[model samples]
Structures are given as C-alpha cells and as structure tokens.
Target: MTNQLVPTSGSPERGIIVPVPHQRPEHFDAETQERLNRVDDAAFEAIAEGRPENTVTAYGQDWAAWEKFCAETSVPVLGVTPGTLVWFVEWLWEQPGKKAGTYTAPSTIARRVTGVTVSARVDHKVKLEEGVARPARARLTQLKNELAKTRETRGRGKAPALKIPHLQLISAALPDNLRGIRDRALMLIHFSIAGREHELAWLRNRHITRTDEGLVVDVAVSKNHPRIVGIPYGTRLATCPVRNWDAWKTAVEELTGEPVDPDEFAFRRIHAKGKSLMAGGITPEAVGDVITRCGEIAGLDIRLTGHSPRRGFATEAVKKGKEREAKRQGGWSKTSRAFEEYVEEAGIFEENALHGIGL
Candidate 1:
C-alpha cells in the first residue's frame, strides 16, 4: 500500500527532495548585490567612458586595494558601513614608508573612498530584485561626511619653492658629452617652453617652425590647449649657444645624415663605434634622472628635475620683467589656471612684488 503524502514504488515522489531559495542563489542580500554591481559598473565606466589613462590606472589600483580588503575581512561590499570605511582610511594612513605615506594624500584617499562607495551602491541596487533591500540613504550621507573630515586632515600643505641657485649650479656642472649636450638642450627647452615631460618627449623637428618674427614651437599637445610659443632672436643663453643649440642641431643632423621629413622625430639615437648609444627624446622619468645626475656632478644636495627649468625660467622672467616685453617672452599664458601654479611654484610673483618696492 502507498501512503498519500509519501510516494511508493513507481510514483513521481519516490526520490529525495531538496529546497532552493529562488531569490538568493548564492545567499547574498540586497546590500551585497548593490556593492558588487556598483564596483563592476564603476570599473567598466572608468575604462569605457573616455576617462584619462592615468585616471583609469589610479582607479584600478584603488579598486584592487578595496577588493583585497573586502576579501580579507570576508565583508560584502554593499554591507560595508561608514565604520568600515573609516578603518580603510586609517589603514591607508598606516600603509608604512614614505611612498605609502605619500599615497595617503587627501586626493588619493578621496578617490579610494569614492571607489568603494560607488561599488557598494551599484551592488546593492542590482540585488534588490532578488529581495535584497536597498541600504538607507542616510548611510551614504554618513560615509560622505566621514570622507570630508578625512580629506580636511589629509590636505597637503604648501611646500617651499625649489631653489634657483641649486639649479644654476647643477646646470653649470653637467658632464661634457653628447648625452650632456642633449640633456642641456632639453633643460633649456623645458624651461623655455614650460612643457610637461610627455610634451617634451613627443616634440618633433617639424614642430619647430621658423617664422619671420622668431623661432616658434607649435605645441600639438599641452596641459591646457594646443598653442604656439615664439622665441625672439634677442634671447640670450646663459651657456654657449654653440653647445646648446648649434651642437644639438649638428648632432641631430649627423644622426639623420639626410634631410628629415617634417613628420619625422627631431631626436634620434646616436651611435658610437657602430653601436647605438642613447636614443633621443625625453621621458618624464628621464627628466628626473638628468636632474639627479646634474646635482651629483655639481655636488649639491638638493632635489632637481626637468621641472626645474620651468621654475627657473618663470623666476628669472618675473625678476627681469622691469620691461613689459621681457615678461611677454616668458611664455606665460594669463588665461590658464596652470599659470598660477607655475608662478607659485617658481615664486615669481613674490619676487616681482618685492622687486616692485625695490626691496
């Protein structure tokens, strides 16, 4: 005889039965779902939404750190509370060593916090359909409030201006060689152009155009916008022009040994004894190396880099700007916000202010 509730032989209910929760396949709640969704979306958007490459790389690093933290703590991202975020910030603060300490700058911390918050929000929202409830809006508010406080504490203080004597001394002591000549030219151009490292690296021979007025450099890519800079004939070099410009031109011509097309790179690799030595073009890191080597040769214990040229140019321009024409030749764009930074970094404004009073 077969029981009514229990199946007997050949009945459909003869096998063992298991139960499954339809809403929660993995047993994750709404908060977890939202956090997961938010992280995924943020990463995808950062890459796909035309964000700058540097920004994307930075966000990727922040996301990786957050993921590691969550995995170690066994905490679902959506369930991360303000308290947890505070701990993360504190962890960042205690990251150890100068590199890590510097990494905890206010801007860096803010980005990391933003990454985590976005990830949590997305994951929570996505899981809501599975019966997971959205987190209260107040939690987000609290997280932001905490982040603001941390930012206030982490804001960077003004650093002292890089010294001019240090730069002048270093420039004077650079070793005499083809590499040195190239470095010196790069230094001069960097200062004269107030160019970023990447811009300097990408400079081509065709970019330098000779107009009736003077030598004009057409900056295709710059921090603010594409612009043209002209250097008049009267500009004097502190060092010998033969070593600075003439030698550079000769070296470049020798390397190419032929008429170079306009699109070709102005700088090329130099060869010695039939083997290529150093290639031309400057990288951002190379700029720093040049400064360091110059410092070592000069026996000066100061931080210097390609940026020093820019600072030196601005400082000297503001000092020599008793005449309006001199100030105009400094290549400063009044319209750009970066002008203020360069001015401040060079301390040119302060120098000019003091000079105005004949102090």
Candidate 2:
C-alpha cells in the first residue's frame, strides 16, 4: 500500500534530499515498483536538493520556463543540444520582461542557461558532452557580446538607485502610529547594516546586544554567512537606528503585555484595526511592500523591492566616496566577481571623468 524511498546517505559528496511537498499518490502494479522508483527519484532530484526555499522556488521557475519553451518549439527537453541552447538564448533575448516591449536582460538569460544545464545533467541524466557543451558555451559568449553592445547603445536595466534624501522624506512622511514606528525601525536597521530582506525579517531580540558605542546586531544567517555588525550611535536624533529600535521594542512589549522574548521574531505584523501583534515572523515580501508603500508616500514612481535598501546603501556609500566601506557593510565577498558589478553600478556616475572638468 506504501512505497517510500529516502535519499542514499553517506558522504557529503552525496547531496541532501528534501522531501517533495504535495507528493501525488500513484497506484501501480508491484512489478512496476522498481522501474518507477528511479523515475520518482529523478523527478525529486530535478528540484533543488539541499537548497534554500527561495533558491528552490527560483530554480523551479527557471525549469518551468525552459520546459515550456522546449514544448512550444518542438525541441527535445532532455539531452538538449547546443544548437537548441543557442536558439534558447536567442529566444530569451527576444522576450519581454516587466516593462512593455522591452527585452529581458542578458544576466537573466545566463541564469536560465545555468538552471537548464544543471537540471539536464543532474536530474534528467542527460549527457552534456564537451562536444555539445562547447558550442553552447560559444553561443552564450556570442550572446553576451551582443547584449553588451545593446547595453552600450541603449542603457542598463530599470533598478533605480535610492538616495538618502528619499529615505529622509519617506521616514518623515509616515503617519505617527504603531505601524510607522515599526517601519521606521525596520528601515533604519536595514539601511545601517546593509543586510538583505530575509536577514532583517529573521532578526531576534537575542541577536542584538547593547554596547557602549551603539548596538551590536548578530546577523545569525544571511545570504553570505553569519556575522556580528556594529551600528554606531547617531549624533542626530532624527535618523538614529538605536533610538528608533528602542521606541519600536517598547511598543512591541507593551502590545504583547509581556517582556519581549529574546528568541521571538523582532518584526511582526500589527493588526490594522487594533494594536494586536501577529503570531508569526514577517516575510521578505512584506519588507518589499513596506519599501513600495514608503516610496509611494515619498512621491517616487519607481518599482522598489526588498533589495532597495542594500542596493541603496551601496550606491549612497559610493556617492559619499566610501567604496571600501560599502563593500564591507553590504557583506559583499572580496572573492566574488559580482563585486565589480556593484562598484560599477554605484560609482559609474560619481567617479566619471566629467567630474574633474571645469565646465
């Protein structure tokens, strides 16, 4: 009546297996059990094994897109050829993204290729021989070159770099209420540390320690790794993260009618009608909502997300001529090639040659 299979375990080289959610029941003859086991294993492996939920979701989306494209084009999804990959890249280049009539970014196309490659080899057991992979690589190289040219002729994507004045305006514009206090605290803490959305949402009172200088926040888990970051006391009361946190924390304690539990989530949803708190931690999406709402109130018409604060921190720091400080604060690893992109994006205008001109 039951056929259960667990991932083989031994060495770290063997990947961790997370159970697939909402697994469907299959009624089959006992004779076919062995044959279907491998198939089921392959299906599960197609998913991101041992990966974070967000990563799994992204990979799933990439795979789904690839699958859809293959079906539509009458191309073999499994054992996909280099020619097919080249075609896929071209197809990606032609597709519209968020904006009307605008093509997708080259970076996005590159990730889709990576996702398809991994899924084909690891999950589908398709052989990606050097002969096949080489041409595909060459085609991708051509695609990159073409995209670079297009970027030079047109411009980069639509992520607007937020500034300090925008932050000040948004903060000042917020209504004087419990939600406002929470949002102000969230923004200050998020911007100061230059941490990711999940990092801010997952924070706990236990992870924060009072210090002589200001506050030491222990980011227990982040996109990179865990680290203890310092938030220095602000000379200005208007923009002080420590002060905002104290006010928010006091309000939270009062609403809960108990001392704030160190282990509990620092940020939670405040009920709209009353002063009651939600029972769970806030999501990363909620962080984006806060940014969007604040941005609207500040009279900006740009699409903002949770990444705004981190990106804003980098851009603002570079504008202030503190490139090294920005990298360190944002937890951007020195070894990562993506560091260059961050620098380029942040410092492109600030460090331009025209700055030195008398005109």
lDDT of 2 by residue, 29-88 (tens): 665776777886776585547555555555677788788888889887784778888788
lDDT by residue for model 1 (166-247), tens: 5456557775567666666666566566565555666787887656665677777554455677655533454532236456
Per-residue error for 180 in candidate 2, Å, reads: 1.7
Worst 10 residues of 1 by lDDT: 127-136
In the order shown, the candidates' Cα RMSDs to the true structure are: 13.4, 12.1
Which candidate number maximizes TM-score? 2
Q: Which consecutive 10 residues in model 2 have the weakest lDDT in total? A: 152-161
Candidate 1 regions exceeding 4 Å error are 1-90, 97-104, 107-168, 210-214, 233-246, 259-282, 321-359
lDDT of 2 at 51: 56
TM-score of each: 0.55, 0.71
lDDT values for all models: 0.56, 0.75
